[model samples]
Target: MTLDGLPERGSWKGLRAENGKCQFLSWKNDFKPDGRFTITFFRDAQQTQPIQTEHGTWSAANGKNELRTDGVRMPDVYTYKLTDVDTVRYVSLASDPSGDCQEDYDFIERRIRG
Candidate 1:
């Protein structure tokens, strides 16, 4: 989709997978002047905390205007886009060596409290 078709930062709540995994994505400092601001999610419900990686952080250099989680990379990096201010999408760059362990994710942000 075009850049305008992406989601805005903070508009997203989190990412929930079909396996009952919930990931939290947040950004602060307007994409700069922040420390380890990450957009992370869980691999499954078993995870007590959000996942972390090198690419996942709160920075303007990551995505459009919103923060995205990785989608197709080895460790994956999430970034943001502004397809629509109200709608945010999470793109994951998950990867596997043998291609058999493939575990990737892509989702949109949904507001929980309007």
Candidate 2:
């Protein structure tokens, strides 16, 4: 990862689905200054409406991108690494002994001016 890895402002998208289910998951992430960040989840590619939204803050933690979401349900900490200028690998720090939420997901981000 380089200084140009996580741009000051941009968007990232990724998809998640289980067991060939019709209901899939899409993540749309927006980055901004002042430690503000927003992650929106859409059920489909059209992205017409968001099924859930998480408001959070992002910053560097131990050379990794750390995100702390606000709310009781959301994970308190998430760690990410920018594999390159256009891709990001994200994983939640919270443990899932059942192997449900422990998988890593890579998001392909689109650079945007903000």
Candidate 3:
């Protein structure tokens, strides 16, 4: 299921411990074809308890195998692999020295469809 192109323009959702430690449960990312992206963090798996939202620009490089997100903080980079047409796994390339454990985990996101 390896894919070599930009991710589909839409919403993608995944459930994981916030910062790989907290009880917060879900992360939803919306990617637009125009390079704009938004990430919503939820405290529940159902995505009803949104805690925070971040906006940024995104780009794909390294033959479309890498995804970079530029936000208010630092630019985060990830190397991604497609698990299926509707699912992808992203490994963070940046390490967190604050011991957040975010880099210790892999994110698996499934495309959200209407």
Best by TM-score: 3
- Candidate 3, residues 14-114, lDDT tens digits: the string is 98655565354688999877777888888788889898887767777663333344433456667787777788888677642432345345678899989
The reply for model 1, stretches above 4 Å from the true place, is 1-11, 19-57, 62-76, 94-102, 111-114
Order candidates by lDDT, high to low: 3, 2, 1
- Say which candidate scores most in lDDT: 3
User: Which pairs clash in the backbone of model 3?
Assistant: none
Model-by-model lDDT, in order? 0.41, 0.61, 0.68
Per-residue lDDT of candidate 2, residues 19-46 (tens digit): 4323467778887677778988887776
Model 1 poorest 10 in a row by lDDT: 26-35
Each candidate's root-mean-square deviation in Å?
Answer: 7.5, 4.5, 3.7
Model 2 earns a TM-score of 0.63
* Order of candidate numbers by TM-score, starting with the best: 3, 2, 1
lDDT of 3 at 72: 37
